[model samples]
Target: MSDFKVFPFETEKQWLKGRMIGIGGSDASAVVGLNPYKSNIELFEEKIGRKIPKDISDKPCVIYGKKAEEYIRELFKLDYPEYQVSHHEYHILQSLEYPFMQASLDGELVDQDGRKGILEIKTTNILQSMQYEKWKDRIPDNYYIQVLHYLLVTGWQFVVLRAHLNTEWGGEKRTTVKHYFIERSDVEDDLKMLLEEEKKFWEYVESGRKPPLILPEI
Candidate 1:
């Protein structure tokens, strides 16, 4: 709820370069060793310019998700009419309180009560039964860390994440869309914890010191 800054990028190159300046929502889980795809050491290396982050734009799943994002966001607006939805193209929100904290939101929301919230969209392939179970009663740990990072950066009142899960069963393809809501009031302690962890990670970056590798849970 303090002050923040909005940065606009005109090109993909600029956006990618800017991400190095801070810890982003996607980078949050990696910082805490919760992201299965990326490790804490990798994130640290990327932040310190020891390596360039891989470009996933050409990946099939990445391509599909990018193309589907706009349509899915439209569907969310139609389905959740109680909240006013809006989006800003190619802009990142940076926290003044914690300059190393940033958020690149899919969309934003304002409820009837004038409370502002975040809109996060995800598209993933559910290839196995275990993958589906991760979304059964709760958001996956990585995603929960992501939204919490967004909340920490923007200080939003709530978050609504819409996930589109694609799966194939018996040679038949199907898509299931699920929505989850998170209230900031319910996760104040989590926010505090994430902030502290992120601050420690950023310190390592600023000091040009490598942090100990944090392995993901199996």
Candidate 2:
């Protein structure tokens, strides 16, 4: 197996840093380095209490994500008319205690079957969580932007979340499936603006200056 462990110890901090930079529209996988420990794939399956297919991990880097993503799509009823694999490359900046950020992403998905769009895979227990509204929406922006920013970069036709509820805990035996389709122009604009701001921040970082003390628009 791979030498990766679960998200552990300083990993939470690293995850936090990556999360913050992500709000500023940085690349995903930017903070993975900070996580000295990582979760095993088995833990992922076990926690989800589902069997990850044998070939799931064998796909080419470009298509590797779909292995798990598709199962989630099928289970969640997320529309995946067709899809194309998209690869992620993180650009690291800074070297403080946690470094700038070790961001990575749900990667990108290109819908090929008239469903031309972006694919984002989410794993959460949100199924039982009550629904909230925008403006008053309590959902984390970092989480939304992870996919938003990726969509901003690629100009994909649409953005889709092929997600599953991680209900393997709480003695629950069945998993929950879900999907979110974001095909809004306003959101795309907002994400682009956010990415622009992040690019500005990156320029400062490249010049060895600390990032501005800016709070996210939660």
Candidate 3:
């Protein structure tokens, strides 16, 4: 029998590809988004068919390394805060012969107090009422594989999400934890799809073939 590996399809991969690029079609003076290199408000705005509102745009909320460390520390040591915790972001990358293979990771836990989890903290604006109730109750699809991906990177048995809720438009601050138990087989499936997509992506990069989506096949 032939031994060609099959790729596991992940919607996240298609999602990631789009984000890796620079902005798409947002006018600078009129748009409100992160001006940093990784911000793609213009491109993402085009895909979603809505102006990426300045309030909830993926602007630099917190820098991911030392700054992120300070943020976590503040969360843990703030004046009478709830659920003191710490976290960090790790870019898990398996390099090929040249460079790049499977690359993705939101954060890693070095001192989580025996908690094997990833913290996917999201901040949003509330026009009328607090929308955090939805995320508090359930970690939606956007953050599903993301949490799992962090778990896979850390080699943890399970993954949990610690979501911090805050609002720019007057809302109660809240915290919640959601758990996801993905098995070895599940992570393996994600990896296979990831590698396959990586190969195809490298091909595209070499040949200058633009791919519609670069999201992982989780």
Instruction: State which candidate has the highest lDDT.
Output: 1
Compute each candidate's TM-score over C-alphas: 0.97, 0.48, 0.42
Q: Which stretches of candidate 1 lie over 4 Å from their true place?
A: none
Q: After superposition, how far is residue 105 of candidate 1 from its true place, in Å?
A: 0.4
| Residue 134 shift from truth in candidate 2, angstroms | 10
Which candidate order results from sorting by lDDT in descending order? 1, 2, 3
Clash number for each model: 0, 16, 12
Q: Write model 1 residue lDDT over 88-178, tens digit each, in one string.
A: 8778889999988988899999999999999999999999999999999889999999999999888789999999999998999999999
- Candidate 2 regions with alpha-carbon error over 4 angstroms: 1-70, 73-115, 125-139, 168-170, 215-218
* Alpha-carbon local distance difference test for all models: 0.92, 0.43, 0.38
User: Candidates ranked by TM-score, best first?
Assistant: 1, 2, 3
Clash count for candidate 2 is 16
Using TM-score as the measure, which candidate wins?
1
lDDT for 91 (candidate 3): 32
Q: Model 2 lDDT vs. the true structure?
A: 0.43
